[model samples]
Target: MYLIPGFLKPSTSFVPFSEKTRSMAARTNKDNKDASGKSDGRPGLGQLAEQHLEDMDACIQNSGLAPDTLAQLKLWQEQQEQTLKAWAKRPGREHTSDADRFGESLQDWERAKATFMAQAAEHPKEDSTARDFFSHSSAKRVNTDTVMAKSLKQQYPNLELVITPARTCNLIAYAQAGLASFETIGESSGKNPESLSWDLYVAPARRLDGAQGGIAERPFFEKYLYKWRGLEFIIYLVDGRDGSQNYPSVINYYILTPTKDKAQLLILEVGRWGADMHGEILVFDGGYWQKSGELFNSIMKASWDDVILEPTMKQAVIDDHLTFFTSRETYTRLKVPWKRGIIYHGPPGNGKTISIKATMHMLYNLKPAVPTLYVRSLSSFSGPEYSTQQIFAKAREFAPCYLVFEDLDSLVTDSVRSYFLNEVDGLKNNDGVFMVGSTNHLDRLDPGISKRPSRFDRKYYFPDPNLKERILYCRYWQSKLSDNKDIEFPNELCNAIAATTDDFSFAYIQEAFVAALLSIAQKSKKPGKSDEAGWTEDLGDGWVGILGGGDADGDLEKLVLWAEIKKQIAILREGMEEKQKVQM
Candidate 1:
C-alpha cells in the first residue's frame, strides 16, 4: 500500500501537505459549514481528518514516516485548515463537496498503488525501482488513451477529434490530425486538446525500382489522405547548391487538377517572395491565382504604371504582387471557377521568378506560421511515363502542398506543347493544381501555347526595372549592405546609370556595384598609393569611366583597375543572362 505522510492528525507543529491537497480539503470543509458558518461543522470535518491521520500512521509504522511525524502532522493540519476554509468561502460559490474531493484523492492514491503493483509484477525488482521512485512523489499516472487524445486535441483544434484504440499515439497520428484539420476554423479547448499546427510530415518520397518498394500506412494516414476534398496543392523547395556555384534557395508550387482519365499538374513559374529566409510559402488557391493575375494585368496595361512606374520597375513588381494578395475582395472577384494558367514573361534579372514567390506570400497571406511544401522540379518524381493527371493524383496524396515548375515553356516543346494542350483542355481541368510558367523570349513562345484564351490568358511582362525601380533596387541592395538602411542613390548618377543601362536587369545592377568596389580596392593596392581608403574621388570616377573623366588619359593611368571592373561586370552579367534565358 502507498502512504501519504499523515492523514489522521490536526497538529499545529508539522510540515503540511501539498498546496493542492490542502486547498481541496479546505473547500470540502467550507461546503459543510452549517447555517451559522462559524466553523460549525469542525467536529464532522475533524472526524474525516482523523480517519486520514490513522491511515497515514498505519502506513508510516510500516516504513515512510516516523512516529514523531504524527505529532507534527496533527499540528500542521489544524493550522492550515483554518486558513483554507476562509480562502474557500472568499470565492462565494458553493464549496466543492467533501465526498467528491476526498473521493478523487483516494482514487489518485489507489491508481498509484495499482500502477506500482502492475509494474512490479511485470518487471524485475531492480527495473521497477525507477517507476516506484517517481510514483512515490504523487505524480499522476500516464493513462495512455487519455494522454493520446489530449495530445491530439492540443495539436489540431479545428478538426472533429476522434481516436481509435485510444491508447495509440505516434508521429503519424500527429500528422493526420493536422491534415484533416487543414480547412477547419476555430481553436480547440479541453483536456489533451490540440494546439497550433505548424507543419505536416508525409512519408518520404520513395522509388520502387529494383526491389526497393513497400507499402506504409499509419493510423491517421488511413483516415485522411483518401478523403481529402478540393484540389491537392503542393509546393516544393529544391536545394540547388553545389560546392562551386552559389545560388539563392528556390521553391516552386503546383496544384493538381484531378480527373478520372488522368491528372495534370500545372507549375507557377514566377517565384515567391519573403522578407527573410524564414518566410512562409504563399499558396494562391485557384481563386487567388486568377484574381491576382487579372488585377495585375489590368494595372500593368493602365495608367497605374505611368503614375507609379519608376525606371527599374521594382516597386511595381512588389506592388502588383502585394495588391492582389492583400485584398480578399479582389481575390474573390478575379478568381475563376476553374483553374486558369498564368505565364510570366520578362527579361532576365528583372525578378520573373521572385514575383512568383511574392504572389504566393500574398495568396497565402504571408502568414509565417503555416506549413507549406515546395517541390523544386517535377523530375524528382519517378513513376511510369504517367499522364499529367497521374502526376497530380500522386501529388494530392501530399496535399496542402505547393507544386512549382521553375521554367515550364522550355519543358514543353512544339510537340510536347500539343500534348500539354490536350491535358489542360482535357477532362482534368478542375483539379486543385495551380500552374505557372516563365519565359524570357515571349515572342519565341510557341503560339499554340499562348493563343489559347483561358489556357494562359494572363501574361505578365517583367521588363527591365526602370528608373524608379532602379532607385528601389538600390534601396534593396543598400539594406543588404553593411547597415539595414536605404542609402540614397545619387539622382544624377542614378539617372545616368539607368539611362545607360538599356536592358540591364537587377542582376547587372548588383554587378555594377561589385565592379565599382573592386576597382576602388585595386587602385588603392597600386604600388605607390599610400591611401588605404582606396582611390581618390577623381580616380574612382575615372575607374568607373563616366563622361569627362579624362577617358584616355585616366584609362591609361588606371588601366588595370578599369579593366578589372569592366571584366567583372561583363562576365557576371553575361553569364547570368545566358543561363536565365533558358527555361527550367
Candidate 2:
C-alpha cells in the first residue's frame, strides 16, 4: 500500500477474498497437489486447509479489514491491473529499453527491488551455508621466506639449500592465518612423511606474537628472478635525464639456485637493462617512471634492436682491430690464453672514442649486453692501496665485461706498464674479459706495453676527419637541424667552415654550436631600453663573424686563423702546464 513506481503488494496480507477469489484459491491449491503428485502424502491438503482457516480467523478478528486498509488494498489492486494491461499492450513480450520498465533514472532502484520478487516467484537462491563449497580465503600479507625458498629451488633445482628461520620463542602464544608447503627429501615413495622437509613461507595476517618488524626485512622482487635462459646479460632501466642512481651500485650477488651448469652473469633494470659479468649475477633498477609512458616503452624495446657497429667503420678497422677479435689464426695460437687486450690509439677528437662506443653498441647487438666502463681520469687508478689490482679486481667481479680504459697512457707508466701488461696477458685464456684501451698519445706509451704479441696485438689509429668525413659530419648535424626552420643550415657554409677548420677535433666542431648560441646571446639585446630594442644590431649573427673578423690591425686575421689551427696544440700545452704547476 505504501506505493512508489513499480511497487507490488505483499501477497501474505492481500486478503480481500470475494466469492470468486475464494473459489480460485481453492482450485489453484488442488491443481498444485495434483501436478506435484504427492505420493508420500503427509497432510499436504490438511496444511492448505489449516492455512485457509487461519486466514479466515485473522480477517474476522481484524473486523473484515478497516475502511483505511480496504482503501489502501483497493488502490494497490488497481495499480497492479494497470501495470498488467500496460505490459500486455507492449510491442514485444520483453522490454528492451530499461526506461520502459524502470520509467527513468530515479525508478531504477525500484526496478531492482522488483527483480528479486519476480525471481522468487520462479526460482530462488539457496540460503544454506554449505552451498558455498568452493570458496577459498586470501592471505592478508605476502610470505617473503616462501618466495625466497621457491626462487632458490627454481634457480638451483639440485642444490642442497637451508634457510635459517626467524626466531619466535612463543610458538603457540597466538595465531591468525597460516600457509606452508612440503618437499620430500629422502625418496619419492609418497608414503614417507618423516623424510619430507617442510619448507615454511609464512605471511602472518594478524600479528599474534605482537612483534614489530620493519618492511626492509622482506626480500625484493628481484631476489626471486633467477636468470632462466643460458643467456648472460645485465639490463639497466636508465633514467635518461639523470644518471645518478640509474644503475645498481652492488652489481653482483649469487642466488642459492644451483648455477654451476649455467655460469653467465646478467643485470636488468626497468628503464634500461644491461649486464656486466658473463652471467653469474644480475642487477636491475627502475627509476625511469617520471618520463612519458611512450618513451619508457621505447627504452624497454631498445634491447631488441640490432647493435652492430656501422658497417663502413667496421670495414675500415676490420683488417687491423676486428681481426684481433675474429682471427682464427690468433685464436688458435692463444687457444688457452686467459685474457685478451687491445690498444686503440689516435689523435684526440678524431673518432677513437666514437669507435669504442660504436663497438660497444655492436657488442650489445651480438650478445645480450656487457658491462661497460667509461674511464675519464687517470686518477681512477691511483691511490695508496689504489693499485691497478683494484681496477682488475672490479673487472674480475664483472668478469666478462668490455673493460674499456680510455686514455690508457694516463694509467700505465713505463715503470708500471709491465704490471698492466702482465695483468692483461694473464687473462689471455679468459676470453670473457675483453679489454680495450684508447689513447691519443700512442708514441708516449711504454714500449713494454706493446711488447706482448697478444696484449696489444691489434692497434688502430684514428686520424683526423678528412674532407669526406667532414661532409658526413656536416650532413649529420644538418639532419638534426631540420626540425628548426628558423636556423639556416647551408651545406656550402658547413663545407666552408669544415675546410677552414684544419687539425680541428670533432669535439671542437660540436662545441662550435654552443659558441654559436653564445654569439646569439652576446649580440641579441633585451627588447626595449634606453630608446629602443634591447638587442644589438648584430644579434643572431652566427659565431662565424666572431671567429673570422679578428681585429683592425690585420693581426686579427692571423689570430683568428691561429685559433682554429692551434686548438689541440694549445689544449695539450695547457694540460702540461697545469700538470707542472700541480707538481710544483
Candidate 3:
C-alpha cells in the first residue's frame, strides 16, 4: 500500500462506506430534493453523477479484472468521451469542460448550418430599425448636470439651498484642503528642473455647524459623481479628524474612466488645480512657471529677535513697512499709489536673507494674511518682457501680496534692464503690491531700477555687527547653552569671546559658537580623561589676562578649562583671516 506524506494527510478520521452509512447518505440526498425535482439550493444531479463516475473509475482501477473485460470497458469509455467532444464542437451551443452527455449526430450539425445559411440568404440587408449600442455618436453623450440633479432629488428630497459670495467659496475650499489632514508628494518639473510638490487631503461629507452639538449631514455627497467636459468625475467626501480635534473633513476628486488616455487628461487638470491653490512660492524657470511646496522650517522660524540687527534699523525696515501697508486708506486719500518698495544691500554673510525671512513671517501672520511670491530667476526665459508681464499678472491676481526678488542684480541683467524697469514702473497700477529686493552689490544694479522713485524707494544698508552687537550675540548663545545642565558657561567667557572677535560678522560669530560647542562635545566622549588643570603657562600673558586669575573659583578659566575654547577660537580666526585674504 502507498502511504501519504504526514504533513499532507487529512486530519479527520475517515469512515469506510457500508450498508448503514449508504442508507443514511441516501436519506440526506432525498431530503435535499425539491417538489419541482430541481436542486434544493445545493449540488444538483449532474454533480452527483460526476462524483459517481469518479468512484466507479477508482473501483475499476483497484479491482484486478480479466484483460478482455478491462479492454472492453476502456473502449466504451473512449467512445463516450469522443462523442461528448464532437457534440461540444457544434455551433450555437456554448462548449464547457464539464459537458459529458452527447446524443446529436453529424447529420444534425450539417442540417443546422444549412438552415442558418438559407435564412441569411433570404434577408441579406442590415436592419435599419435596430439601435447599435456601441455607436460613436455625439447624441449618446451623458448629461452630467441632469444626472447630478436627478441623484440629488432622489437622495436629498428636502435639502435646502443657500447662495453666498464667491469669496466665501474660496474660504470653504481653503478650510477643507488646507486645514484637513494631508500628505505631500515631491516632483521635479521644467527643462531647467525646478521642484514641485502638492498636497492630497480628504474631504468630509458632514459639516459641523457652530451651534452646540449640531452636525449637518450630507449623505448624498458621500460619493458624489458628476460629469465635466464629457468626462466623469467621482468626488468622495470623507469624515476625518485632526490632532486633538474631532469631526474634520476631507474632499478628494477622482476621474472615472477605463481608458488610460482619459485618465491622464483628468490627472493633468487636477495637477493644475493643485499648482494654483496650494503653492506658496511661484518660481520662473526654463520659460515656465512653477510653485514650491512650503517655506523651509528654518526660514519660517526666523524672526527679528533671531537676527543681529540694530533696533533702529529693524524698526525702520520691518516695523515701519508693515505699519505703512495698514494705512491703505491714508495713501488713497492722499491720491498716491498704494504700493511700496524696499531694497536690502549688504555684503555676503550679513543679515540680509534672515531679515527677509523674518519680514515674510511677520506679513504672513497679518490680519488678512499677505501671501509672498518668491521669484527664483528669470535668466532662462525667452524674453524678460514676457516673463515680467506674467510675473506681474500673477502678482496682481494675488494683490496685497509681497513680491520678493532675491539677488536682484543677477536677475535684471543688461539685456533685460529696460524691460524689468518698465514692468516695475509701467502704466499698470501695482496697487496693494509691496516689492522687496536684495543684492550684495548696489553698484551692479542699474540707476533706473535702484535709484528711481516709486520703484525700490527705500534702501537699507546691512553693515557688519559691531563689538557691542557681537557681545549680545555671544550672550544669546550663552542663554541657549544654559539649558544644558552638564555645561558651564561663564559671563566673563562670553565677554572675552566678543572682545576677541572684533572684526567678525554675526555669521562668523555663529560659526565660532558652533565650533566651540562641537569641540566640547568631542572632548567629553573620550575615556580615561580626568579633570584637567586650568589654563597653563603656554597660553601667553594676553590669554591669561583675558581669562582672569588662575585660582579664582567659577572663573572663565576654571569653568571650561581655557585650552579647549582657545583652540576652537584660534581655528575660527585663522579661517576668517584666510577668507579675507582671498577676497583681497
Candidate 4:
C-alpha cells in the first residue's frame, strides 16, 4: 500500500456551492480557462483514470503478493476504472482536492495483484530469468458457485480449480499448522488495490468466546494469498450481493491453488471449521455443525448445587455421568460396547435442563476437556436421515463426548426413528459416546428406544421438587436478593413460599418468584397527577393491604415479596389446575 503522491484522504477544506457556482460563472473572461484551467473546460476524468492506472502498475511491480493470473485482474481494472472516471466528471469536483479524492478512490494492490497473479498462464519456455520463482504457475478460478467465478473459469479453460465454500472449511489455517507453513501478505476489496481506497464499516456483534465480535475491520471485498508449505495460492474473498429481496451482502471465497487435491490432507486434518472450536461446543443444527459459545456460556453458569432435587438423586445423577466417562476400561474388560445412554424423564421444568448444563460443565473441566457435541435436531438440507448420519458420524469421531438429545420426543419422530435407532444400535461401536436424552412425555417414545436397556441403559426421573427442595430453591433466590435494599427476603419466607407453591414444578416456582418480584417493581403514575415524571414503585391490587398481617408463626407474611408471592401463587395455582384439567 505505497502512498502514491496525491493518493490520500478526504480534504478538510471546503468551498461553498454558491461561491463555487459564482467562481465558475465569474470566470466569463474568454481566456479564464473555465473551471479545469484549460482553453475549454474539461473534468480531467480520462487523465485521472490514467494516473490511477499508473499508480496501480507501480504497485504491481513492487508488491510481490498477488495471484499468478491476469484473468480476474484485468476484469477488475476495467470495472473500477469506469467508476473512477464517472466520479471525476461530477459537478461538485471544484469543492474537492484531487489528492484527497484520488487517495479515496485510488487502490493499487488490485492492479499489483493482477500483474502478480494476473500474469501469463505460463512464462516463456526459453527465456527463464523470472526472479519471482513462480514464473510458470497457472490458476483457474474454482468455487464456481458464483457467476463471476464461473465466468473466470470459462475464460481460463486450461486452468485447474479446487473450489469450496470458504466458510464451510478452513484450508489455509489448517494447512498453516499441519500441512504447511503459510503467510498472508496483503488484502483488499476491489481487484485494483491501487484504485480508490476501501472504507471500513462494522456492526456490533455479541462476544462469543473471549474477544468482542463485529468491531474489527471487515474488508467488504478482499483477497488473500497463502504461501503454504511450498505452494503459492491466490484467494479471492469477495462480499457481493446475495441476490435476494432484502439485497443484503454475502461473502463468497475463491482459492486458486497450485494444484487440485494438493491440500487434501489439510482439509482432512482441519475437518469442519466448527468441528473443534476452542472455548466452544459443536451444536448440530441447520444441517451443519455450528460452533456455539452461547451454549458454552450457559454450561459455564450451571452448577450442580443450583439443581433443586433430592440430595441422593442429585448425587446419583452426577455419579452416573462421572462413572460412565471413567469406565471405558471397565467396559473393555467386560467385553461391553464401551458406550452408554441415559434418559432423564419427568414433567417439564423440574431440573432437567440445569442438570444437563451442570454435567456439560463438569465434563469440560476434565483433564483432556471432553467436548460436548449437542444434537439440536435431525434436520438438514439433505434430509433428517442425512442429518442423523452426520450426527452419529461426528459423535463417533469425537467420542467420549456428551451427546445431548434434549426434548427426545420431538427430535426422534416416525419418519427417521428407524434410521436413528439403527445408528444407535449398529455394530459401528459408539464407544465413549455417552448419550443423554431428556423428555417430559416418556410414554410418547418408542418402546424400542425407551424400554430397551441395550439402547438407553438407565433412566433418571426429574420429578417436581418436594417441599424440602422447594425451600432450598426459595433460599437460593433469597441469597441473590440479599444485597438489594428494595426488597425483604427472610429465611422463614423461604418455607412460607415453599408451603405456598404446593403443586408447582421447579419451572413454575421460578415463574412465581419472577412474576412476584416484577409486580413489586412495577411503577405507576398516580391518578389525576399530570407531572410527566410522577411515578411510584408500588404493588397495587390490594395485595399489600390483604397480606399486611404477619403469619402467626413469624412476620413472613408482612414482607412485600411475600405479599406479591401470595398473589402470584394464587394466580399460578388456578392456571395450573386449569392446565391439568385440559391435559386430563
Candidate 5:
C-alpha cells in the first residue's frame, strides 16, 4: 500500500529503473506504514518525496560510472542548487491579493519551463545525441538529489559532528599525523587575497594511539583521528606529567567544504572570528601554551591618570615607549629594528605590575589592537631555551604585539642565558614587537641578558612614591571609599595618612585603606555604636597598642590603625628589609 507523491516524477530518460531503487522505496513505504496506521493521516508528503529521492540517488551512485563523469555530475548539481537558492531570494513583484501570489507562481513556473525547453532543444531527437543527453541529465538529477539528502543528514546527524572551514584543517592534521603528512601550500604576501598567512596540504591519516607517561611508569592511552563527519579532521592529544600524576588533553579540528547552505557557513565563520577577536592572555604551562581566559585585572581598569608616579619617570618609561611602538615607519626610516624593550625594576609592592596592566589595557584598545602574550614561567618545559624559542615564535606570528616577561631574572636563568639573549637580539628581525620585562632584583639577572643594549635597552626604576605621590595615592583611595554613603571620608584623613606613611609603597597604602574601611563596616554594626562619633572612634583606634591613638577629632598617630593591617605592614617592611639586606 505504497503511495507515490506527485513531486516524485519519473525521469524523462530511456534508462531502465534499477531493482535496488525499487526495493529501497518499498522498504521506506513499509516503515512509514508500520509507524502510523492507515486510519492516521498519510505520512508527510515532503518526507515521502525526500525518501524517494534518496533511494534513487543511492541507485545512481551504485551504477558503474567513470570517476570523472561522477565528479562532473556532482559539480553541475552544486551549481543548480546555488542557482535555485539565488532565485529564491530575488525580490518578486509586489502583490496585494491571493490572485497576485498565484500570478507570481505562474510566472516562475513559465520561466522554469522555458529554460527546460531551451536546454532540451540543444540535444535533438537524433538517437546518439538523445542517448548522451538523457544519460547526462539523469546523472545530474541524481547527484542533486543525493546532495540535498546529504545536507539534511548533516543538519541532523546521529553523532556529534563539529564543522569548521577547510582553511584551518591542517592545524588539526598536524596534530594527528605530525608534520610529515603535510606540505606547505602557499604563503601569503602583504596584499594576499586570503586572510590566512599560509596554506597546507594535509595527507589523510587515520586513528593512531597516543600515549602519555614515562616508559618506566604506567602510561595512559588516547586515540587521534584524521577524519570525522564524512570530512577530513585532525585530532591532537597532549600528555603531560606533574610529579607522578599524568594530565592529558585533546584538540579536534574539522574542515568543512563550501556547500549550498551559505547562511549556516557564514554564521559559523563569524562566530569563530568573534571568539578570536576577544583578547586572550596566553601563558606557557604543562609543556604547552594555553589561554588563561579574558584579561580582568582590577589594575587594568586603572588608567595612566590613576597611577601615582614621578612625572619624569612616567614621561620617559610609559609615554616614550608608547610613542615608539606606534611609530613603526619612523623606526624603518632610521634603519633600526622595529623592536623595543623596557625593564621595570623596583622593590616588591611598588607600581611595577599596576603600570604593566595599565599599559596592556592601553595597547589592547589601540586602533588595530595589540595582543599581549604573558609568559608566567618556563620551569615546566624540558629546557628553558626550547620554551623561549616557542614563546618568541608565537610572538613573531602575532607581530605588532606586546610580550610581557614577568620576573626576568628567574625566567632567563644561567642555563638559558645564551638562548634568551639570542632570541631577543638575534639576526632574525623582530619588527613591530615590543617587550616589557620586570624584575624585583635587577642584579640577579646575567649582565649579558640584562645589560645588553638591544635586548633590554631602557631600564626604569619604580621607587617608593614620594610624599606628593603618596598624597595622590591616598586621594585615589579616598574617592574609591566615598562610594559608600555610610563612610564619611574627609580630605584631612587622606592628608594625615599620606604624611604618616612616609616610606609605604602604593600596595601598602591600599591595604591600609581596605583594612580601615572593613573595620568601620564591622564596628558600625556593633550594638555600642549608635552615633557617627562611635564609628569614628572605632576607626581611629582600630589598631590598639600598635599606635597610640584614642579619639578621631585630633592628630592621628598612624595612617591605618587597624590591628591586622598594622601587622601586615610590619611584616611587609620586615620582608623588604630582609631583601635589601640580602642585596647589600
Candidate 6:
C-alpha cells in the first residue's frame, strides 16, 4: 500500500526502485497503523503517492505532451493514488501485487506510445498533421491524423483514397456553394465515428444568401459518408490547431471514393469553379491574382459613345481591337505573330481610360466572352520581376484576353525595365493577347517600348478636346439640367462656354459643368423659368448636342449656366496653366 520517495527518476525509461524503497521496506514508521484498522499520525498512502509523482516532476515534464493529453494522464494518476489509499485502509492485509502492477502500467503507457510512434514514422505528412496553412502559422500538432488516414486506407481497400490539404481544395465549401451536391447516406451525417467531439459555430448568413436570416451554423471538424453523383464517398475534415498563432495549424480533407476518377472529377470541378469566380474580373495586386466583381461592374458603364473622340479616330480604335481578335487567320496568313500591343498616349483625363474600358466592354460582348486581365501595380511580396512573370503567365493562360497596363510610365520603372521587356518580347508566343498600355506623358516612356513598332505596334494620342467637342459637352450639360428649372442654360450659353474653354480637356469641361451646377444648387434663391429662347431638344448618346434654334448672337451673360461656368472655367484654366509651368 506504501511506496518510498525517490522511487522514480528524472527519465521516463524503466528502472528499478532506488535504495530508498528497499530501506523503507525493511523498516516501518513508528506512527504506521497495523492491519487492524488502527489510526496513526502518518500521512495516508494516497498523499504520499501524490507527493512521489510531484517529486518526479522532471520525469513527467521530459515527456512533453499536449495540455489535453497531460490532463488526462494526471487524472488517471490521481485515480490510481485513490486506489492505493483504499488498499492502505487495510494496511499490509494484501494486494502488494497491485502496487507492482501499477509500476508496470507506467511502462506500458510509454510502450504503447513507442509503438504508435514507430507506426507513424512509416507514413507521409512531413512528420505531422498539416496544421498551419497560412503565412501566420508553421507549427504541427502531435496527433494520430497521419496514422488514422493510413489505417482507413488499409481498412477500405476497394475505395480509392485521395487526401488533400483543405486549403488547396475545400470539398465542404464546394458543396456549400451549390456547385456540387453531397447528400448524406442513411444513418450517417458526416461525423467521423471515431471522433468524440466537434467544433461548430454560427456566423453571418447574409453572406451566403441575401434573403436568409442574419446567422447560420456550420460544422468545423466532421466526417460523413455522402452519395455524390451516385457514387459513395467518405469525406473527413479536421482542425489541427497548435495552441498558438506561429505554428502549422491547418485543416485537412480525406476523401474515400469508389474510384480515383470520381474523386478527381469532383475536385477538378470545384477547383475550376472556385478560381473562375462568377461576375468577377482578374486583377493583379499584392503579388497575386484577385477576383474583383466591383472592378468588372465599373467597367460595364464604359460605352464608346461616352468618349467624345471624332468618329474616325473612335472607329480606328474600335477596328484596331476588333480586327485583331477576329482576324487570327489574317495574322497567320500575313506570316506575322498574332500577338500585338497598342499604347494610348494622351494628356490627363482626355479619354485614355474610358477608351480602354470601352474596349474591355466590347470584348466582353463577343461570343464565349473574352476575359480581361487588369494590372494596377507591380508592388508585391516577391519582387516586381516575379510580378511581371506571373502577369505574363496569366496573360498567356487567358489569351485572346485584353491585358491593360494603366499608367505604364510609372509601372515600368528603371529597376524592372529589362525584365519587363523580356516577358513581353521573349521567345514565348503571346498570341491573342491584345495588350494595351496608357500613359499621359509619352515622353517619359522608354524608346525601346515607345518608338518600336515591334512592341507597341500603334500609338493613339488622346489630346485635349477641340472647340466643337467642348460645345457639344456644354449642350449635353444643358440637356441634363433642363428639368431642374433653377438654372437657365440657353443654346447661346453652350457656344459662349465652349469659346472660352480653349486648351481645356474634357475632364476640365466636365469639372466646370459640375461646379456650375453645384453653385446653382447651393443658391437659396432659385432662378425662375427662362424668358430666353430654348433650342430644340437633341437628346441622344451621340455628339449631336449642336441642335439649332436659339440665336448664336443672343446675350449669354444673363444665363445662369453661362455666369457660373465662366467663374469655374477661369479657376480651372488658372490651375491648368500653373500645372503646365511646373512641368516645364
Q: What TM-score does prediction 5 earn?
A: 0.53
Ranking by TM-score: 6, 4, 5, 3, 2, 1
For residues 1-584, what per-residue lDDT tens digits would candidate 2 score against the true structure? 24321111112244443544334323322212223454333223223433443443353345333222333334444453344345335533132331233234224324533543443333332211111110100123243334444543432344434432112111111111121111111111111111112344555544757755334222111112222343321111111111235333222132232343332221122101212122222211121101123322222222211112234655755334344444446656866554567787777666665566555544544444555434443343243124555556656765556667777887676656666666666543345566778889888888767555666666766666676666666555555445533335555545655675555555555455444434444444643212212211121111111111111223322433234434534554466578779989
Tens digits of per-residue lDDT for model 1 on 84-129?
Answer: 4554454322333543465455456456445544433444222111
Q: Top model by lDDT, which number?
A: 6
Count of backbone collisions within predicted model 5: 1
lDDT, candidates in the order shown: 0.40, 0.41, 0.53, 0.62, 0.52, 0.65
Residue 87, candidate 3: Cα error in Å is 48
TM-score of each: 0.37, 0.39, 0.52, 0.61, 0.53, 0.65
Q: Is candidate 2 or candidate 4 better by TM-score?
A: 4
Report the backbone clash tally of model 1: 76
Return the TM-score for candidate 4, rounded to 2 decimals.
0.61
Residue 232 error, candidate 2, Å: 27
- Candidate 2 residues lying further than 4 Å off, grouped into runs, are 1-314, 318-330, 333-339, 368-370, 373-387, 390-401, 521-584
Query: What is the clash tally of candidate 2?
Result: 36
Off by over 4 Å in 1: 1-338, 366-375, 384-404, 413-423, 429-434, 441-446, 465-489, 518-584
lDDT of 3 by residue, 29-139 (tens): 321244555544544323433344354354336533222223333443444344434433443122222222221322333353344344334322211101111111114
Among the numbered candidates, top TM-score falls to 6
